[model samples]
Target: MSDQQPTGSDLSPPGESTSDTSPSRTAQLKRWAALDTTSGALLLTAATIAVVWANSPWRDSYQDLLEIEFGPAALHLHLSLADWIADGMLAIFFFVVGVELKHEFVAGTLRDFKLAGVPIVAALGGMIVPAACYVAVVGIGDPEALGGWAIPTATDIAFALAVLAIFGRGLPVALRTFLLTLAVVDDLLGITVIATFYTDTINLPALLGALVAVAVFAVLVRMARRWWLLLLPVALTAWTLMHASGVHATIAGVLLGFSVPAVAMRGERMPRTEWFDETIRPYSAAVALPVFAFAAAGVTVVGTSGIIQPVSIGIMLGLVVGKVVGVLAFTALMVRFTPLRLPDSIGLRDLLPVGMLTGVGFTVALLIAELSFEVGSDSHAAAAKAAILAGSVVSAAIAAVLLRWDARQLRDPDMNRDGIPDVDRDVIGG
Candidate 1:
């Protein structure tokens, strides 16, 4: 995912550590993956390098790299390097999203209608306002550009959570959970937008095949615990058929995720969902997302004029300003009027940063942009990508500042936000 290139050479001298404390390479990786900001930093670094590569004098190499295609052509599998990452690797990320969604709905606080309704409703508002902003902005100038209205409707869960975890250290866990639920719901809505508004054609026969494979996978997974290796082929079959069916291949991931049972099986001590999360989420975070970001974010600079075009500006406005307004406004109204309530020690002030965090729409926004505009090199595509990058940066920066402020001003050790202080709270960055 590092452009398939090695990164950040180590130059410092080796430091001494206690023999007992020294961990295995796998252990180190697992801990690093758990660091909360590691994935976000990796994503940002890959994206920054991609952007620089796209703009540099050796930009031709960048294009060549992306154009390199592989996979069997007969099975309709021949695809460019970009397609491989966007459609293939990105599915792993969505799979993680699916797991989180399923877990939240089945066993987490989201099961409660009143508690879940806040984020669910806020997510809808977040999507609606941004789409409206995009349509209003571009439709007024270049009506054709309105096709990209869904670009800013997504909130990259990883990126948003990373910002919150790093900068909002003292904030209650409720805030993080709220954002997670909200972002997951937001992405679900975004995927719906993709599946509904963007898909122009369908192959019903292949779609049916995909559903069957998904159902088979669902049953096979729950039937036994050691059936994991066998499940791979079924999952791939589902993905391939869904891809051929003209529906987005990533939907297969969500479907497969929905297939996994939340309850523990016969011999399992924990639920399969948690097991899958522990097993696969690290890869998704470290590899899948960063790779997708690298491929999605490599928008070449054409000129300032195109970069700041009306369509581009509209995307930026929708992502930055529109997401904040939508999330904050809907959440405020919900908390004020309805029986739905936020966790204790959290207030509207807490939601201000959360609102800003929701605006950090990077990976999913970029995906929608590609789907919105024509594939390959196009001025409109370039402008939309540039705008998404810009908007995401602005949103993350503002959210970080606000989260830091909130942490300092409203520091509370109530990690779970249940009005009771958690004595076992983890030390920040430990």
Candidate 2:
């Protein structure tokens, strides 16, 4: 089935519309993209600085800051800076994820399952087999460690999109679509993992409070017709309640994201000059994602002493090796034996390295590390951080190089695959 493109103002939620042809609309989009890129660049720079500082004489200060405790008198919440990023800033990331998820389901790619099949299958392949491999090898003895299994189950959306952008027009548009689809499914899996595995011994009061918030949010969403400013405050309240309830605060972010009404602004008309979604959604993607990336990507790496510990080794290997093997192997088998053609632009050769790149699990890996790190095992947590750093660096470098090579091939202008020209090929390769 061909994917349904969102169109016509009738689909607009009541009041959302704008003049798409206006120069202002284009300028707004450009601004949004600029914000995304700048924030993304900052994140990359911050991560690099963290790595350098962790190894330098400033390493002590770096470690100290992350470990420094700050909280209140009566409530007495204590956590390191790293923990603050992992558990706190990350909730915002999940909140965004929830928004994206809702958008897709309501109006975007997953609007039809057949159109969504390729990436859905690919993401499932990417997640399930790696986890099975991890559990089979070392999962027999400790069930607590089972929480770590979900670590390899996600794809880093920012990194994937960055890789695609580098390839430019040499890749297929379908590739981006497929990758986006895959990441969405992959994130959903990660959410399930957190909900099912990473919770503290359940607290009834907290759960009840969460349920109440969810109910109230739903009621507000349905009844309140205006594009309400209440979203931010309500989301914050939900985050606090989730935190207090002992549920992962990040989940609260997701729930709040869902509650945010996508209702059209008041005094709007169908098929108007501006579309509400196109206007507001890109800001989240371009600005919010990159900031989250920069804030979450950095992990101070000092003292090589315990950096190569067993848990670290497992995580690194799982992300670097496990993702590639599982995703590629499953995809290969599916295309080979079944009717689903390998995306027309990707042959077995090109697919191999792309699979390898999917292993570049930076953002998701950090999230899983936070979820896995139980109380008092700071060293274990540190090891997980080190492993993510090492694995992501290696995966990103290798994948970037290989993708560049493939992109060059697709861009040669002289070569065509099975009657398809280079320009068309580039879009697919993306």
Candidate 3:
């Protein structure tokens, strides 16, 4: 063999570079996972800083910055930069959610009913039971508290994943997969709740405008084929229409997402590249989520009364109690009555920790917190935030410990791996 070995043409035919720049799909996935990890760390860091800053001597400036007002007189609208960021920036977040929902429904996890059933049921139970708990405690007594119904209804994927990672080697990757799938579906429920229960007075003209814009978007999305560029203008236009209409602007994300071409493949051929799915998810989860967390997590609780208020109590209870009962109970029933079975990698003991992690509802909870106090009730908002922060932290901590311990046992290798039957790992993960 020559010392130089085989060069491009010799190694593989023409057009092949020795440099390997074609981008290994595995490498890309690893990189995305790493970024997700980092984003989660950043969110935790930002949240810590927000709590510290809110309680520090510099708290006034922080509060003032959040409340600073600025807007135009054209439509006669004005709100503090904080409100705009919390409400407005969050609409984009919802847009991302819509896209994800569409993606999942079209070709992702929700693609097959057999695979989708467990998560779908778990997510529904998780949401409904929590809402029921909140209602039983507050919503029924005073319907005003009903806005808080969506408070405990979501699971933050970042936080949940991070907790799973902390458990390290022992986690039966199946449990992680199940949790992720459940969170995605739970997010869908949260979005529907926002659209159905959260709107104010509907402006028909504006609503009609939004519908027309959505139709235009559908046309553009279909015509553009795999073109990612087309989505930008259409998304903005949808946002404008949604904002003008009485509908929550965040639903625009769902619309845009649904309009995206998820079924790009037809018959034997791969449809165009899955650029949007591959590219957008990492960008949203890494960059958009952290930025949103930084802007949204800042709240002042320093000089205020330390007692956990009713709103906070409701949120904390709804998440901590509701999620655990809902997920476990539904899963238990499925395992008992139906032919469905737990992933071979998971054990009966592992369910509790995973269930605890399901209570980490940062993103959606924050959005609902904004809605619960959109009328500018400080006590109500603060209480809601406190509850969310507390519940998320407690749930994550408990889950982390439980998962870590479970991981240790899982790595033992002596444990039986019966009934697995070697199905594709992604199916369970989904």
Number of the predicted model whose lDDT against the real structure is largest: 1
The weakest ten consecutive residues by lDDT in model 2 span 1-10
TM-score, cand. 3: 0.83
TM value for model 1: 0.90
lDDT of 3 by residue, 141-248 (tens): 456666687898888877787767655344555666677678888888888887788787888887787777777777766663455466677677777667778777
**Residue 103 alpha-carbon offset, candidate 1, angstroms:** 0.8
TM-score, ranked from best to worst: 1, 3, 2
What is the lDDT of every predicted structure here? 0.79, 0.61, 0.67
TM-score of each: 0.90, 0.78, 0.83
Clashes of 1: 0
The best candidate in terms of TM-score: 1
Which one wins by TM-score: 2 or 3? 3
Please report how far candidate 3 places residue 350 from its true position, in Å: 2.8
lDDT of 1 by residue, 192-293 (tens): 888898888999999999999999999888875456677999999999999999999999998898788887667555566765665677788889999888
Q: What tens digits encode model 2's per-residue C-alpha lDDT throughout 85-192?
A: 666777766766776676676556776765566567777877877677556544653444555777766677766666555553465565666667777778888887
Better-scoring candidate (lDDT), 1 or 2:
1
Report how far residue 80 has shifted in candidate 3, in Å.
3.2
Q: How many residue pairs collide in each prediction?
A: 0, 20, 4
